[model samples]
Target: MESIVSELEGTLVKDSDPFSYYMLVAFEASGIIRFALLLMLWPVTRLLDACGMGDCGLKLTIFVATAGLRVSEIESVARAVLPKFYMDDIDMEAWRVFSSCDKRVVVTKTPRVMVERFVKEHLRADEVIGSELVHDRQLVRPLPVIFHDGRLVKRPTPSTAILILLWIPFGITLAIIRIAIGVMLPMWAVPKLSRLFGGKVIVKGKPPPPTSGSGVLFVCTHRTLMDPVVLSSVLQRKIPAIKSELSNGDLVVCPEGTTCREPFLLRFSALFAELTDRIVPVAMNYRVGFFHATTARGWKGLDPIFFFMNPRPVYEVTFLNQLPHEATCSSGKSPHDVANYVQRILAATLGFECTNFTRKDKYRVLAGNDGIVSYTSSVGRIKKLVTGFKKVVSTFKPFIQ
Candidate 1:
């Protein structure tokens, strides 16, 4: 048995091109005929509709038969029929014909040799779908058909037919409705909706008085595309940072902009600072990794808008920080360890316990009780404690009646 297998492994075989078989199959299949009919019907139907013949369109009722062509022959024909399409200097029609075959053809010159080589090299079909041949040390002899199924057998049903039969008219109706609404409704409806739902203002602390003439480094968590918008609303001022590329045409703010490139961003930042007296830095904490800064995909192309808008008068340096969650888990430290470290750092640097670090419902909330603080929680209880202390101080103010 081992000797036979070894002898068979080294044998060579030849195969018919799979492309020819597929082209033949595609030519015969009713699905292909239906698609062709639809393609032909579209323009004709449009012309008829323009002439008040709204219901007249071609229906696929007959199958067109054609002579079976060889894969090589089809390649030449396709090159002549469609010269625009090319693949690897070979006519794509060849590939299409082969890919459409029902089964890949394989021919073995000797029974002792495996037929796999021929199937792989010449046919390039996912599977061999034909008979093997045996040679008695001299001439080729046909064996029983192997009938291997190719990958093409698992074709998904084409949706185009269904769309033409049922969904096309419905889609046209929906498009008409959309156009009507667009023309009839006020354009402000969209911006108003955006303001109501998309606009978010998160008050980290008391808003600075207008007369104070002081600036702050606004820091918050950055998660969604709407964070900056929300932050700007909360501040009630144009964020000094920058607008993202997608927000370019839509933004009302003049000074801020976003950029992906580093060199251009640095130069813009420097120039903006030179023109603005109050450089309000903005930062966000992303919930992944220990990196202090992240390149936001949406923020690219903001620098050009900022440069053109030109909303500055004096020079000042304002640093923006983007802190991702991964920064907490630095050097393989566990979440608990990182959380504790963050707590300590906040307490030391800010001179107060961190408060309102956890999210509640749709909004972030301060912890109400010690029991609410858990080791598994993403936010620390320190922030909550600080917020609570501030409320108590406000209640006992000396000038209060």
Candidate 2:
């Protein structure tokens, strides 16, 4: 708050009777307040600060470059610093006025990733311009790996473990109920569940039916942990893999291994070629959320579902032409070539840059992990007494939050 007050005070260079001048003032004031609140609440900022990044820190440098360190420099800095989580925790209350505003809405934000296609999400918005700050052109910040959402069986604290155990029957029961309804009446139930959970799915072009009996592989770009649910509801089918041979119906598959914020697409896995000829490449974008889940398929446990169910997520999907499935293309292309060709198609369709780096690379860099399970690691469990039956507390700090 002191920072906000000082920033505004420092920037007052001139006073004019023009209406535009006051409006400019208002915009600067609004942007600073919003960004100040955003910075204070962001866990990542706190984490970075804890790592000895005080005023002369990496984040402060980026923030100053994007926004301004001094009041006189604020407007010149130009872009607003939006935390990565804006999509997941959207405040509709804050956006309501903008949704209905008649004036030209220009969203200038930082970290180039945040503003990608954000203009398309709001129909009434006029323009948006974004910027990015990179350490040698790559915005890779080192992060620590946590066991929170990666594996099928997460090692939880005693309290959360008990809560999960208690919720098992409920989760199973809910899963069964939803599955029965979805499988029996996907055409009807999926849309209903989607709306019930505050999700919107937009599709482009005519695509094969989800119920098309036979082998069909649905491929698309990734965005957010909520994707599996949105994709499941949008396609009206679960894309789960099975060794039981899915020679029968349509099965959807996400091409990019995990949700990504980078403009580039991760390496392609030729899984579609291994399946039947009905390989459909799709382009996907999301209106909200940035926390990309790093765990592999079938590894994430139920608690991960908690984020998807948090309310307000939107998915936009565009299906492209089916890839050539011939053993040899007309140009004598192998299956590997065919896979790359499909990746190109998907990239061109969605405006994503194609890259060879795996999602694990992002996980390792972003999570500050060695990317290998620590074997032969042991811990001594120490507990503190609790008043009443409240539960025990551990004195040891977690590796990562």
- Regions of candidate 1 where Cα sits further than 4 Å from its true position: 1-160, 179-184, 187-401
Per-prediction TM-score to the true structure, in the order listed = 0.20, 0.45
Off by over 4 Å in 2: 1-187, 210-213, 224-228, 237-239, 289-299, 302-304, 325-332, 369-401
Please name the candidate that would achieve the greatest TM-score relative to the true structure: 2
Cα RMSD of predicted structure 2: 16.5
Candidate 1, run of 10 with poorest lDDT: 260-269
- Count backbone clashes in candidate 1: 26
Clashes by residue pair, model 2 = 87-288, 87-289, 88-289, 143-367, 143-368, 144-367, 145-367, 152-299
Candidate 2: residue 302 Cα off by (Å): 5.3
Expressed as tens digits, the lDDT of each residue in 1-401 for candidate 2 is: 01111111112111111122112222233443433333333445446668875433434434433353354223221212111222223344444434444433333323333332223232223343335322112121222111122221221222333444455455545545443444455354666775654556787867776554565666767665444455555665455433133466655566666656545677777665666666777777765332222332122343234333323445677877766546324446655676787778878877777877665555443332333541111001101111211121011001000
